[model samples]
Target: MARFFTLEQAQQLVPEVRRMLNEAVEARAELEESQQEIAECMRKAHQMGGVDLDTGRLVLLRKRVDELGKKLKEILDQFEELGIQVKDLNIGLVDFPTKYRGEEVLICYQLNETGVGYWHGLDEGFRGRKRIDRDFLDHHEGDLVH
Candidate 1:
């Protein structure tokens, strides 16, 4: 079941989520770097007729790529377990599920934002985000009593 969070509840988790998201982003970047390096190596090998390829370095790069991929997956899994939606890893965008006026919506947060102050409908996404206001506060629902 999807876990719904009130604005306050989502705000409370920002710090921890930010840390994990940053870690995940770094891991993803490293993974991409490794993959690019491997591709370059393969390209070189193909062009040189595989005559001077360093198999050992290629193996090590592949291993590092695997490790970094696993690390990124673990971080993403943590977000899943917590019911947080990772929208954009490169920019550290996420959404906390909630219901506004009896309809499902998202409490959106981006890296370095002051707090959870924006929200949008499921289909609206980031582009349609609206700033939290009194109407939103009076209508949103979550699992928490407050």
Candidate 2:
């Protein structure tokens, strides 16, 4: 069975999760920059003539891209190991799967946001985010639990 988080547990993770999201967001941005640099190198090489297999700069760019990829993968693996679903890398959006009213839903968190305040059905993605009840979050009384 997939890991599930209770409302209390999810709320408790807000601060740490926020930190993790920030790191992931930064890493993803760096990875993207490396990829763009590599693409530009490829474009320049192709524009000049047939590709040069022994080009130093191109080789360096490729190496940087590989390093960035590994870094991003490590961050993602950390998230998975924490049972957080990576919904959107661009926004550093993630979902914590949990049960509510006997059904599964996700507690959504995005890098730009503070605290987990939204949720959506198993079928609903970020676009379907619904504001969580402040009452439920604050007290956790009578709120759904896993």
Candidate 3:
């Protein structure tokens, strides 16, 4: 089942979620860099007839890529377990599902933001974010069954 979050509840998790998001973003970048380096090395080796290449460095890069992939996966799994949706890894954008006026909406957060102050409909996405105003505050709700 999809877990819903109130603005306050989502705000409370920002600190920890920000840390994890940063870690995951960094790991993803490192993973991409390592993969690119390995590809370049392979390309050079192919062009040079597979001679005079730094195989040791290539092996190390491969290992680093594997480690980074595992780390990224763990971070993503944590997000899933928390019921947070990762929108953009590069900018560390995420969404917390919530109900506004009894309709599903998203509480949006991005890296460097101080708190969760904006929201949008499921189809609106980040581009359509609107500041959480008095109307939204009064109507938005989290899980009610519990």
C-alpha TM-score for every candidate: 0.96, 0.82, 0.96
Model 2 RMSD to the real structure? 3.5
Q: lDDT per model, in order? A: 0.93, 0.76, 0.94
Residue 107 of model 1: what lDDT? 98
Model 1: per-residue lDDT, tens digit, 1-146?
Answer: 88899988999999999899889989989998999999999999999999879999999999999899889999999999999999998899999999999988999999879789999999999999999999999999998422
Which regions of candidate 2 are displaced past 4 Å? 50-54, 134-146
Output the lDDT of residue 68, model 1: 95
Candidate whose lDDT is highest: 3
What pairs collide in candidate 1? none
Q: Can you write out model 2's per-residue Cα lDDT over 86-141, one digit (the tens) per residue?
A: 88878878898876656677888887786788888888788888888764355322
Q: How many angstroms is residue 140 displaced in model 2 relative to the true structure, after the best TM-score fit?
A: 9.0
lDDT of 1 at 88: 97
Q: Candidate 1, overall lDDT? A: 0.93
Candidate 1 Cα deviation (angstroms), residue 12: 0.3
